[model samples]
Target chain A: MLEYFEILGQEVYKVLFLLVPILVSVAMIVWLDRRVWGLVQKRRGPNVVGPFGLFQTLADALKYIFKEIIIPASANKVVFILAPIITMTLALVAWAVIPMSEDLVLSDINVGILYLFAVSSLGVYGIIMGGWASNSKYPFLGAIRSAAQMVSYEVSIGIIIINVLLCVGSLNLKDIVLAQKDLWYVIPLFPMFVVFFISALAETNRPPFDLPEAEAELVAGYQTEYSGMMYAMFWLGEYANILLMCAMGSILFLGGWLPIIDIYPLNLVPAPIWMILKILFLFFLFALIKAIVPRYRYDQLMRLGWKIFLPFSLIYLVLTASFLFYFDKLPKGNF
Target chain B: MIAHSIFFYFFSVIAIFSSLMVITSRSTINSVFFLILDFISVGCLFIMVGAEFLGMILLIVYVGAVAVLFLFVVMMLNVAEQKQSWFVGKKSNHLPTGLIVSILILLELLVVAGGWKYKENLMSSSTLILSDISNTHQLGLVMYTDYILYFQLAGIILLLSMIGAILLTFRKRSGVKKQSYFTQISRNPSSAIELKEVESNKGVIIDD
Candidate 1:
């Protein structure tokens, strides 16, 4: 009994260790995203809060805590409350298998990438529930748009991941990172990486692809009826999801936790720091994209995903598989 | 051992409870939500049983994609007004026939399961391999090497079905100026631009 309790306690501790940093980083990334956005637009963002507005998100979080939560009378109260919780929980849960370094993950499961993909795919449900539970037209419209968008993009994202999986011959994320010791997948699979990044944007509902939350038309989309801490939970969950995508981008393409080079000074740095830096670089690009690009029209977005990305990735998948087969360089460890 | 049993029961109980909720829920949308929960719990059960790849696929494909589509349709339907029980309501006259057919199918499924005994003489007669590799690898080995032809046939069937769906939905409207992405993208500056020089007194005549 004592031994079992010890194991449970250790597991709990490990989970907390992973989660606390993730939550803190989510807060930090929100500020980073804003600052980067501000930089692109040539303005100071939230500079009144703390040093360079470092504590803006913290202040916002505190404000959310003290505000009154308004639940619409017609709304499905249970689902409305459950929506943000589900979003935040699912977004955070996907991080369990994401390796920060060689062994910094909370749970190093065999099918880590599939687990991530599954959790991320399920993310649409939170928004759908929120939109439907709001019992309003705009939210419903937003939910409908997001449902189609996410489902469409996920097809291409699956194919892109398959391209990476083919070379590594493993669904394990750590193995994927290590497989890039000599050459990162970004070199050979550059087009797939771009598509994956774009899909990630659509998946997370960031700007340009954020038709679900297009402020111009939908007010706040699924979040229109949410208020107080409930609203804050959605915001936190969104940023965390963006961060997760950035982490995935770094892991799949840039090589998670691997230093830029194997030289003396580069090798001296810790592995997780490299991972964090790559994530930040990708996050920076995401911020820049929000500032620079105009939003795509709905039809155009679908065309890009289905008409272009689907066929492109499919052809690349076949080519990569055939090439590997012809060369007999397919990973021997695979069946 | 005890913990494994506990998890197994935990997931199975939730699965059964949620599946019951899926049918009994008053709201259609809520029923779809419960169905999603059912998928998730069943997926958890699969993962607990060591078929992690299949478990993840169940989560990704069914709970993520299929259930979302179900929820989408349910949401669009005036769900607040839909309180019809499964056994009753106007169009439910066929329910009896449906139940009979479903039960027959269930019995056939049972027969299919029991007929696996004859697989002892097949090439991959060993049902489960206790190999050190992951379940995905084990599945790939059996699926690709032994049943490659059947797999290819299944793929063709799925492709045909998808093409059929598109064909059924696709309509041609004569007046609609649909965006021609191919022509749009293929236009180079030389092809699209008319570098016409106009004389000072005579302007170039525009042609439609």
Candidate 2:
């Protein structure tokens, strides 16, 4: 019993080490997102708070915490309360398997990528539950739209992952990164990388594909009823998810934690910094997309996911498989 | 081993309790939610028992996709007030049939679970549990090598069902206009418009 408690305590400490940085980065990323958006529009955003408005998100967070939480009388109380918590928890929990650098992951399970996929796939429940529990028309519509969109895009993402897996021969994230030591997947699998990045945008419900929360039509969408800390939880969860996508893009395509050049000077830099830089670079692109692109029509989004991405990814999968098989470059699976 | 049993019992208890709630919940949405909980707990049980691949697949395929669709349909149908208690509705005739079906299913599951002890043929399969490999690699090896035909058949079955679903829901409405990007994009000035010399008193007759 004493040993078990000791193990549990150590695990808890490790988890806190991983999660604190993640949470703080999430807060910073929200600031970064807004700042990027503001810069795109030629405005200085949130400069009133601390130096360069770094504390803007902090102030906003405090406001959310101090505000009142009003649950509608007609809403389903249990589910209403559970939705945001689920959203935030699922969003954060997926970080456990995301390796920052060599041996930096919380859980180095063999099926790390699948675990991430499953968790992200389950992320829909939060939106669905929140929308349903709100018992409002707009939220419900938003929830339905999001549910279908996530499911559709996930198919292409799965195939895209399979494309990388075919090359790496293992589902381990570290193995995936190490496999790219010779060359990053973004070079050869360029089309799939583009598709994957776009799908990541859709999966995270970022703008352009953010029809679920289209303010023009659906008001605040699934968040129509949430306020106070609950609303902040959703906001926090959204940024965390976006960061997760950025990290995923970095890991799969750009090579997680691997230095851009494996030379003496560049390789001397810490691996985790490279990982963070890559994630930030991807996030910058994501923010750029949000500033530049217009929201997709619902039918247009569906058509892109289904008619274009689905077939495109499928054909790429076959092509990659045949290319590997013909050249005898396929990963000979044992380990 | 003790910790293993503890986790096993914990997940099994949650699975059983949530499945009970799935049947007893007043609202259909709540029932679907409970169904999702049941799936998650059962999936955890699988993961705990050294079947992590199967567990993740369960979470991904069933809990993620299947149950979400169930919730979507139930929410959209506005049947949340499905408050008619089991065995109270006038259609209580289903209770007898339900009980019979339930018992038959229980027996079938029991056979699947305990048959290895008694049935020689069932234990004769060549694929023994390989300890060295991860579950996913083991699955890939067996699935692609030994059970390749069966796997291909499963894919065919899934594809056929998808086609059947689309066919079932497909409708042809003549009057409703649909966007055809191909036709719209292919249209050119030469094909779409032609200039004609007009007679003095008449506008150009537009019949092609």
Candidate 3:
């Protein structure tokens, strides 16, 4: 065992180093979500709690840790216990593939986009499992709605991604950012930017598309039976997914770690700072939209996804393909 | 090289076992989840083989979308045993299937061990060089240049699948009202109708 540990010496350090930012980002996002949402509603927003609610989530976490976990009498024992763990784990794992900076990524795998998508899709299982395991009608209904809603929007999201992938010619997030060094793809692919952003909101089950959590109907949706820390896991995972999506959007469309106001005759800030700033801006946008937009009826939401966004993205993909083919002669960097 | 080979074998065993469980499981829902696990392991195997692009495609398209949809419907319709007949059968055909699967596994093991004499340059020469093209660069190059036609073929396949799915599920139900785009767009109420009134039961009111 000692020899094996020696063999894996630096690998352990690399793993731990990778874990820091992921943990920090999830923690900060949890704090930010509560504070921001509270402020938007014209409330005191955790000011008296501990230094502007910085420690509110932490306090809540501790409270959950000490609380008794009660399984409902009719609940499925094994799945009920495992669902939140899986949900939280998958949500955290997605941050591994996200490129925070050039060298800051953990996995930096080739199929980063696909990995992100796959992990998020698995998240739906967590919701489904939680709902079904509870043996309750409302959660079951919420799970079904979530399954349909996520699946429907994913199609348009995938197609819009095709358009962006065509522009970058790579699936790796770092490579996508490097491709955007000259100009972000948002300039030319503005429509795709819109499609991807909206689809991401839908994908993360944010407000307006948040049918799964429609409190008036499902009484907190798939989490109706959850209490204490189990509920906290679901909450953490939700905000984490939002943060992950924002990070990916920043990296993919917003030139990731590139400075927006590059007026200093050179890009000065480290890539990670720019990445953080871009993510914060996108995060604010996400919260703003959540506050401003009214939830659509279920049918209207489905129609928007399947009818409008899907067809539009397919057309965008075709246009992108045609341009890439026709301009094959152009110098790769010139444009 | 030995570590990589051992990891590959380990994941392959798990993948194969989970895949078998996917078929043999009693509950349709359990079977679906097992199938997801199998696909994830298969994806890991794909990565081990330096086929990252294909692995990602398998992850995104099948495990992410198709398998989730399968699980979703299985859990939703809550099909009774009657409806599960197509998927779950207690018939005793497992023996033959098991035999066939074991035979294939044995053959693969034989090939891996020494039957093919394929182990000579398996690691030293190829392993170091494999890392260079293992990323998306070579995959993109081949996709855009050599396999461009095949890429287009995949697009056509997806398009066909889209149309097929829509056609299969778009049937209008009998009682549920659906809006017609034509009526909504082209309707001029003045052209279609003239207003009139009739006497009410209580008031005996009338209008022209």
Candidate 4:
């Protein structure tokens, strides 16, 4: 019984260890994103809070916490409150399977990638529930758009992951990274990498595909009715998911925790630092794309997902499988 | 073992309660939400029982895609205002039949659960569950080798359904102006533009 309690206590400690750093990093990333956005627009961004706006996110978080949460009179009270919590919880829960370094994960489950996929896919629920529970037109429309957008992009993302899986022969994130010891999958699977990145943008509802929150039309989209902390939770979940996507892209394509070159001085650095660097690089690209690209029209967005990316990824999958079969490089397993 | 049993009971109880709420909820949207809750609880149960891949698949496919579809249709149809009383509504003529079918299903499930212990040969099945491999790897080994044909057939069925849905919803309106990339791109400056000499007090007939 003592042993059992010890194990449980250890698990809780690990969860806190994983969660606290992630939450802090998420806050930092939010500030970094604002700074980047400011750079793109040629304007000073949030510099008044602290030195170079280092504490802006902290101040914002405090403000959100202290602000009164206003529930719409006609809203479904239970679901309205539940939606933000669901979003925040699901965003944090997916990190259980994500390895910060070789030994840094909370739970190194076998189906780690699938667990991530499931959690990310279920993210639309929060949006939909929030929108519907708000009992308003814009939110309803936003929910509908989000549902369609996420579902469409997930198809191509699934195929792209399958392409990666064929090469690695395992769903484990660690194995996927280890398979890149010789060469990152990005070199061999460049087209799929690009496709995956764009799909990730859509999946996270980032700009250019953020029709769900297109401010000009839907008036903050699904977030129109949300206020105070509940509103902050949605954006918090959004940023967490964006960071998660960046981390996924880094892991799957850039090679998680691996140095760019396997040299003497390069190899001396710790693995988790490399992972963080790659994630930041990918996030820079995300911010760059957000600044440059215009929002896609609804039909155009659907067309890009269904007509272009889906078929391209499908053909790529076939090509990958055929290449593996031809070269006899398919990772062997005990069938 | 005790912890495992406790977690099992926890998930299963939530699953049952939510499933009951899914059926009994007055609001259609509420029913859909309960259905999602039920899917999540059942998925937790699957993960707890060592079928992590299957559990994730259930969460990703059913709760994410299928339940979202239900929510979309429910919200779009504005069915929240049309809440009907359970088994007592004016148009509930099929309630008796529904009750009968549900009871029959419950009995069938109970029978299957009870009969599992008597099936001594079940342990000697050809496709033995391997302990060393992950569930996904085991599934792939069996599926890609022995059950490839069935898998392909399922793929074909899904493709057919997709095509059928597109065909059913597709409509080509007669008067709507649509962009044609072929024509738009093929036109050159010479064909699209002309500098015409105009006679005094006469308009240029550009079409001619």
Candidate 5:
């Protein structure tokens, strides 16, 4: 009983430790995204808050908190409220398996990648429920688009991950990183990496593929009926998911906590810092894509996902598997 | 052990309750939402039982893909307003048949559970769950080696279903103007542009 209590206490402590940093990072990421956009468009971004607008997210949080949450009379009240909570909870929970360093991570589960995949795939529920519960046409349309978009992209992402898994031969995130000690999977699996990155963009509903919440057509899409903290929850959940995808990209292809080079100077930095740096770099690319690329038309987005990325990733998966098998480079395991 | 049982009961109760709600919910959308809840709780139960890979797969495939598909259909059909009472709205001749089929299924499940003790020697099978390997690794070893044909057959079935769905929904609309990339890109400046000397007070006649 005492041992159980101790384990429970430790888990609570770890969760808090993990969650605080993540929440803080998410807030900063929101601000960073805006600033990056502003810089690309040649404008000053959010200079009114704390130094360099560091506390802008805090002000936004307070504004959302104090604002009234309006539940539409026509809406399914229970589901309407439940959607954002589900989104936020799933977004945060996926971090449990993400290792920051060798010693870090709340739960270093064997199937960490699959756990992330599951949580991300489940994210569609929040949007679908929210849109449906709103009892509005635009939200419904948005939900339908999201359902089709996410499902389409997930197939390609699954194939792309399998390409990496064939080489690593382990589902464990840590083992995936360690396996890339000599050479990151990005070098050999460059095409799949690109496919995975673009798919990740779509998976997180980032711009270009953010047809679900396209402002012009759907008027905020699934979030049309949301307000106050509920809306903020969705926003926060989105950034958190983006961060999760960046972390995933870093772990699978960019070698999670591994240094760029095995030389003395590059390896001098700590593992966790290297991991954070890679994630930030990926996030920078994410923000850059958002700034540069125009939003994709619905048909074009579907075509890109199904016709281009899906077949490409499938072929890549087959190529990777056969190459690994022929070269005897497939990691030996229990299988 | 206490923690394990506690979580087991917790997840199982939610799973059972949500599954009941899935059937009993008035709105079709609400039913789909409850179905998702049921899948999630059942997935939690699978994870708690140490089949983490299967648990995540359940969440990803069933709750994520299948339930979202259900929600999409429910929302698209706009059936939320059709709040018909179960077994009360109209005379349903199939109710007796449904009841009988459901009861038989329950009976079979009960028999399977209750008769487990009599099959003590059933544990001596060729394929045993290895304690050392991860569930995913075990699955791969069995699936890729012994059950490869069956796995490929399943893949073929899914592919056929996908092809069938696409073929069923696909239609050629005559009035719509579709973009033809080949024609659009193939035309050069000389072919696309035409310059003609126009006579005074006369418009240049262009050939279509």
Candidate 6:
């Protein structure tokens, strides 16, 4: 019994170690986004209370926990509650497969890339359910737009990822990073990187693709009826997914923990630090894009996703596959 | 052994319970949601079987698309809530279906636990050789080199399904105006409507 207990305890410790970093990482990303936005806009962001407002998310969490959670009288009780839970859970689960550093992943499964994409797509269900459960016109309309928007962008996103998978010849995140050992794939696949970045922003419902929650139109969109901790969960999940995407993009296109040019003791900074720095840069890039770009109209976004991005991604996929084939890089007979 | 056995029993019970609920739930929408839960549990079972790719695909494609479409259709339908209540008094009528499902569930458990040959197979292969090395390369090698033809077949099936769905939705209606470039080119405003000037009988030459 003691021996068995030891094994189970070890498993629990591993799970805990994985979960804590992600939670703290999410908090850090939110704080950094706010502080950096302030710097960029030439204003101090939340400097009053705790040191640089590092405790801002903590304070907000306490408020959310204490706030009255309102379930709309007209809403479907079951789905309304389950929707946010599902959304947050999916967002958290995706990070399980994303490799932070070379060997630091929680579940380094064979199909890590596919698993990430699959879980992320599951997020659309939560959005759809939340909107439908609200039993209101605005939420319903927002849900419809979200469904169309997600589906459209996901097609392009899938195609773009095919290019990455082709370049690496493996679906594992660690392997993908390893493939970038010589030169970061972004140097060669700059156009695909741009396409993947923009499509990812749209996929995550960031600015320029936030028509589903367009304040002037839908009035908070699918989350119109949510309140208290449930709403906070949704917000946190959104930011976390953004962070996860940045981490993934870094792992896929950038050299991940591998240094740029490997000059002057690149080993001095720990692998984890390098990964964090890369993710932070990508996170700032996301915010900068948001600050600069205005929201697109619904039709325009759909057209861009389908007409422009999808074709380019498909072409990129073809190019990648062909290049791999020409170089005899694919596991033979695939081509 | 006890811990492993407990988890297996627990997840199995959950999977069975959720699947039964999928059929028993009153609302079609609720049933569809339950179906998703059932799929997730099955996905868990796949994970236990060391078929992670298959498990993820089950979640990705079936739960994500097919079940979603099921929910969409159910939600969009104008089924009356009262009609759902009509079958409440006829519980006995559903006894056969329930009995059959329970039997099926029992069979599934027996099969999963290896019924008769389970001991033999367990004796033969107790340890699966999965080392610290990543399995992605081997899987890719097998999938591409050995199973490429099967993969292409799956793609063809998907293509066929897409075409079938499109055909079903493509309905032509009579008396609906269809666009034509030639008609637009030949059109003139004067030919489409008549304009006339009349002498004014009242003040200020009224345009009526």
True contacts kept of each: 0.87, 0.77, 0.58, 0.74, 0.84, 0.48
lDDT of each: 0.89, 0.90, 0.80, 0.89, 0.88, 0.79
Q: List the residue pairs that clash in candidate 6.
A: none
Clashing pairs in 3: none
Among all windows of 10 consecutive residues in model 1 chain A, the one with the lowest summed lDDT is A326-335
For candidate 6, write residues A196-272 as lDDT tens digits: 88888987888878887888999999989999999988888888789878877888788788877667787777778
Candidate 2 lDDT over A27-67, as tens digits, reads 88888888899999999867888999999999999999999
User: If you superpose only chain B onto the true chain B, what TM-score does each candidate give?
Assistant: 0.73, 0.75, 0.62, 0.76, 0.77, 0.60
Reference-based TM-score, model 4: 0.92
Residue B154: error of model 2 in Å? 1.2
Instruction: Please give the distance, in angstroms, between residue A13's alpha carbon in candidate 2 and its true position after superposition.
Output: 0.9
Question: What would the per-residue lDDT of candidate 6 be over residues B113-191, giving only the tens digit for each residue?
Answer: 8755533222121222255433445565688889999999999999999999999999988887555546878889977
The residue pairs in collision within model 1 are: none
Clash-forming residue pairs, model 2: none
True contacts kept of 6: 0.48
**Residue pairs whose backbone atoms clash in candidate 4:** none
Candidate 5 residue pairs that clash: none
Judge the docking of candidate 3 as incorrect, acceptable, medium or high: acceptable
In candidate 2, stretches whose alpha carbon ends up further than 4 angstroms from where it belongs are: B84-89, B93-100, B113-130, B183-208
C-alpha DockQ for predicted model 3:
0.40
Which of candidates 2 and 6 is the stronger one according to DockQ?
Answer: 2
lDDT (tens digit, per residue) of candidate 5 on A228-326: 999999999999999999999999999999999889999889999999999999999999999999999998888899888988898888888888889
Residue-by-residue lDDT tens digits, candidate 4, A45-91: 77888899989999999999999999999999998999999899999
User: Which segments of candidate 3 are over 4 A away from where they belong?
Assistant: A1-4, A7-9, A327-335, B77-131, B134-165, B179-208
Give the TM-scores of the predictions, in the order they appear: 0.91, 0.93, 0.84, 0.92, 0.92, 0.82
DockQ score of each predicted structure, in the order shown: 0.61, 0.71, 0.40, 0.59, 0.65, 0.30
Model 4: residues with Cα > 4 Å off, grouped in runs? A333-335, B84-89, B96-114, B118-130, B181-208
**Range of the 10 consecutive residues with the lowest summed lDDT in candidate 1 chain B:** B120-129
Residue-by-residue lDDT tens digits, candidate 4, B14-42: 98998999878878788898899899988
